[model samples]
Target chain A: MAQAPVTTRGRGGRAGTWYLFLVPALLLYSLFVVYPLLTGLSYSVFSWKGTVRDAFVGVDNYVGLFTNEAFRSKLLPALGHNLALFAGTMLVQNTMGLAFALAFSRARRGKRALQIIFATPYLVNPLVIGYLWTLLLSPTFGPANTLLRAIGPDELAKPWLGDPSTALPMVILITTWQWVGFPMLLFSAAIGGIPAEYAEAARVDGASSWRVFWHITLPLLRPAIGTITVLSFIGSMNTFALVYALGGSSGGPAGSTDVLGLLFYRAAFASGDINAVGTASALAVFLFTFIFGTTILLNRILRQGEEAM
Target chain B: MTPRRGAVMVPLMLWGYALVAMIPLFVMVLGSLRPTQDLFNDPIGLPNKLYLSNYTRAWTEASFSTYVLNSVVVVTGAVILGAAVSVLAAYPLGRRKFTGRGFFIGYFISGMTLPGHFGVLPLFYLLDGLNLVDSRLGLMLVYAAGSVPFNVFVLSAFFRQLPGELDEAAALDGAGPFATFRHIMLPLVRPAIATVVVFQFVPLWNDFFYPLVLLRDESKLTIPVGLTHFFGRFQNDWGTLFAGLVMTTLPLVILFGIATRQIVAGLTAGMNR
Candidate 1:
């Protein structure tokens, strides 16, 4: 029934020729990705200062991440920020994305144009998005403030990125602004893929639009929701470039906007300390474990959710 | 909500968000056209005239010419190399049943979760030891290599979905694996290939992180890094900064405009996978 017989014959006869197809990618991926990952793991175990190996420190860097005051101040709060970002993205961004996707799913006129316009932001550079938002949110010269003042919300036009209290939320919003289109696109596709008959049949029974959506559409969209949830969760946890571009390496405004990615970068590159890279490797390992574990768990949960339904 | 209310609200909400998404872009374009003094004075006002000096200033004064060239070269090179390598790898893994196939698939898929930032420092050291630091070629290699996992993942899925009869038929004929891949199987997955191409193009073009870390030479800087430097040097010159920002973004916007359908389909394909 399958290609098992032919594949076995072909495999034994042309093993060398077949593997040649795999060589280029495997070689490059191993050298570029796997090698560096292993090297990072090895580096994490040693104490290095300024690119020089100082001593063999076994899990001391990992342990110190919890015990050390400076590391704790940096890492713990950054972890909190990541959780906050994950929540914001999953709640607000996913909600907004779903709303837009729902809107577009029923849209007839200007559907293509709206999708293009909304998804256009995702096409541009994240660094540029950061700077663009910075300009738009600039305290004195930005258009947002100008419009705010003109609209009689003069006091509401605060420095969006300057105040520590507002900085992380602003970062989260900007990140969402740039990427919300992606989830929307995904959800749009998922919704579009559903047969029209399901909703039509419900409507024929005098189901309200909301009722139809709640009972019929929502269950069908569970897979998409799971995918978006996991993707957004991982994406937010690894948020670095946007934060780097917008909040700077220090994750400024008193590190309120600091996430684990930025903290890892600061530990590796920005800090003038010689032993920081080793510490950074420990952070990387922690992040890898966290991300890998979370992704697997989410995938399992999503599968379970699908199976249960 | 009533069906009437829902129908009216759907388009209204979509159009409203579309306008919101575009306002910053329109503002940037208009601001780029206004003189610095005019932007400072009328931040929200339309440009009175098509002032072209800001663009000229950005093009030459900010070294965007070099940056744009570097960006194009790197993005193009990475897409071509990445697509080729992944197609080659995916053909076997997706179409053929073989020993260690599951292990190999797992190996490639492992990268999807592991953030590139994890091993980037060691990658930096590795590249430096190889004397590839501050080189566009080095940056291109990293981009292409990093793209393999994603490219392979998507392409292999696509390849598997193609009917196996084509491969068997080709095999029944005098066609070898390479010939069959190049002739029959490859053509069947052209859309997937295009999807991979379109998908990788935008991200690689816009990526600032690897270019930031791997590249140090001023001449080799991509648009994002270049624009950041331009921003730092000319923060007060909002006109030129806006112009630089527009220049940095215009290619992508134009690309999106031209290939909106393909881009949308490609994005949806990945998400639904």
Candidate 2:
């Protein structure tokens, strides 16, 4: 059979018009997003403050970032804190969110009402959530400690945020609280996508609810689970506001709660060392690359696993 | 397998979770209502009286009104301009094939993943070179530009979902491309536009990084920055700080409440697809 020629006359004109339509967004994005990124990368190679002329310095920023005792000291522990946050949210938050979503899905009345209530924390600004938690968890007059003292052992009522031992955990808990709903909603939607026939077949085979959930629902939810993991990983690693608000600019009583984001802010702005700004830029670039690489790796792994199945 | 048992378990669990979710907010309100002294003295006790003065203090002393106005202007300007430009850009990428289209699409989409902090110092220098620092317009530009990739990606998906037959019909009527887009395509994407507006608005309104880095003047502070000042001053005064937090959070809470259905629908649409 002879093939017919596709329409190409207006294609050029149409594409050109498309490019024309894109100009304003492209202009703004290039000016503000692309240019700044390239500049930051280049600036990381030079030594300069706000006013001084830039001088070429090679990989010194990256070297200093990895080697500097102060930087390493803070960076290492912050990595631990970030890891803790990741593990906590992935395990606790995701589990709880899934449970809520499953429950809400089965709920007859007030399903919309409960979903709204659950999702409220996610919509609240992180800064606002941080401050609100600061009040609720405050060591002095906060109700959390008071409630603990009133209902439980008085010795257990230590200043939640003030105690160096508890501060990072409290911050992570609050962080998880604010974000748990997001994954829940995602899971709920994904669950909705699974065919009702699958559940029907499982029940017909005498599978219990737990068995159905474990063997069927969770397996079906793999894509959502994968996505939520990557999203939460990136978000936790890049988290700035919650930690900053809870721990303040110093990042804690002893820099115990310090994360890379707060560390970058402090290094770039707090110390006035100007040299540190280059290192901070290097750190930021490292974080971005790390997240980008991790997400790519995760997608590949998930795709491969999906294909295997 | 009984639907009756399933129904009962679900609501009970939902109500339990809802109460847990609402406790912190309730604490915030109660804490804000208590006197400063009473807050320290009787942390869990009922407020001696509802002290509305804290709101006045938060508004004037913390300069929250300026923050509110600044946030309003920045968010409004960003949404209107950002959405217009993004829709325009997205239409071509989504609808038509062109030379370097892949590269152009990649360029825009990459912005979504690039961390904003990486560009902070350079942006500071860039804005300074353009003499745009410490200005609301500068903040607006940064916010709008930072948000473009996501907006473009979202709107492009939405536009792609729209059938091309409408455009064909308009063209058959002798309407030019621009008129077709203006009169036909634009109205068709109202839901997506509304989604973009809400998505961009919430983040822009609540954002702290740009205003923190670009804006130095207290008068130029947005709500997040202004709340920081209140937080600093009242580091110990839980009542006042909580009051400020409540005031700062109230608008967003009310907005979410009003648009709860839309917000959920929009998020599911954008993220799921």
- Give the TM-score of each candidate: 0.89, 0.89
TM-score of chain A of each: 0.90, 0.89
The residue-level lDDT of candidate 1 at B36 comes to 92
What digit string (tens of lDDT, one per residue) describes model 2 on residues B83-194? 9899988876776666877898899988876777778978988999999999999999998898899888888888778876776676668876688789998899888888
Taking every candidate in turn, the Cα RMSD to the unseen true structure, in Å, is 3.4, 3.6
Candidate 1: deviation at residue A188, Å? 4.1
Could you give the CAPRI-style class of model 1? medium
Residues B1-273 of candidate 1: C-alpha lDDT, one tens digit per residue: 777888888787788888888888888888899999998888889888779999999999889999999999999998889889999999889978778888999999888756776889889999999889898988888888888998899899898888767777777787888998899988888888787887789889888778877887889899888877888899999999989988988898788768777776766766565
TM-score for candidate 1, residues paired by index: 0.89
The number of the candidate with the highest TM-score is: 2
CA lDDT, every prediction? 0.86, 0.80
Candidate 2 stretches greater than 4 Å from native:
A1-19, A49-55, A102-109, A194-210, B1-14, B47-51, B94-99, B158-188, B260-262
**How many clashing residue pairs are found in candidate 1?**
2
